[model samples]
Target: MVLLSCLQRCIQLLIWPVYILAYMGLWDSFYKRVFPYIMARFAPIYNQKVCKQKQELFSNLRKFAGPSGQLRLLEIGTGTGTNFQFYPPGCQLTCTDPNPNFRQFLLKSLSENPHVQLERSVVASGENLHEVPDGAVDVVVCTLVLCSVTNVSKVLKEVLRVLRLGGAFYFLEHVAADQSSWTYFWQKVCDPAWKCFGDGCSLSRETQKELEKTNFSELNLRRIHVAPRWSPTSPHIIGYAVK
Candidate 1:
């Protein structure tokens, strides 16, 4: 407990500097240029750890082919295109991210994964995907996104607005640990600094609860614990909601 307390204090100490950077408006630029590289290195490890779960969740995507007979998929927070490998071949993918720097990396991934063609890449937030038409996509995907969004409910509302009738929204996100657990205590303790350094990721957001309140016609969410229990990001939920 002493060591944990020390760790918590250290994290708290780091956030003041992050606040200063953000105040100066340098934080967004810094994250834009650097976060893609960071995810490039971290994604493989995370993908491997969640490989089975991703396969299970992604497999349930209804094959609602567009007029072109290709699955139309819109992936919000398409950081570095990390989930590209798991997408079905011939998917007409539209990608979105608040950070524009990720576009090059996304294009690189698109070139490498020739089977999935890019319909467009928009520099937009999850809460405002106005460029995408109503019922424009057959599937919407968001992985590790809800924790960082400014408004989770608004994003969910936008998601429902954009999906075609019977369309599915598949999400995989690390959420707040169970309230009675040791991890939950640490998550609350570390959230302030985590948001500062993690580009607005909240360590203790009850994302699953938000999903429950969303009016999806069918919701199938499951809570599971990933390995490395000491990490605040270990507790996760993966599932889909249909419009």
Candidate 2:
């Protein structure tokens, strides 16, 4: 327990610098450019596990991947194209991210996933997807995205606007932990620092709840737990909501 105590203290001590960087607006560059480099090493394994855990949910999405009536998939905040392997052939994917730094990594993944045609690589945020048209997308894939958006509700509305009738929005995101837990308290306390370095990742964001508030014909969500290294990424939800 002594080692755990020391680790906690170290984390507490380190938060101050992150706060300073965020306030100074320097964290944005670090988050966009530097963080992806570090994440490229670990995110693949984490994302693969996430996919495996949500395999049943993902199978439903596979139905859209076919030559006849190819699905137009809009993946918001497509960080390093981590979800590439999950997609099957004949998917017309339009990837968007505010950070241009991820372009190279995303391109590499897209090149490997030749099955899914790269429709567009827009350097834009989820809040404003003007590059994509209304009622154009069949599936809006938003994994690990809502937590960082400037406005979750607004983003959801935008998503609803873009999806055609009966289109599905598949989401896998880490939400705020249970209110009574120490994890919740710690998450709340560390949110600012977490957002600073984590590219706007808010540990306390109730993303699934935000999804519930949206105008979906049906909302199906399930909670999940990941791990310590990805402590902020735990207490997640994986499911789809039909528009």
TM-score attained by model 2: 0.88
Q: Number of clashes in every candidate structure?
A: 0, 0
In order, what lDDT does every prediction score? 0.88, 0.81
Please, what are the lDDT tens digits per residue for candidate 2 over residues 1-243? 464466656676888776677689886666667877877787888876776765666677855433456888999999888887787677888899888888888989988888888988898889999888898888999988898899999899889998988888998888898887778767766775677667778998888778877989999888878776347557888889998
Model 2 score (lDDT): 0.81
User: Which tens-of-lDDT digit does each residue in 100-196 have in candidate 1?
Assistant: 8887788888888998889899999999999999999999999999999999999999999999998899999999887888888889788887776
- Give residue 62's error in model 1 in angstroms: 4.1
In candidate 2, what residue range of length 10 has the lowest lDDT sum? 60-69
Give the residue spans of candidate 1 off by over 4 A: 1-10, 66-68
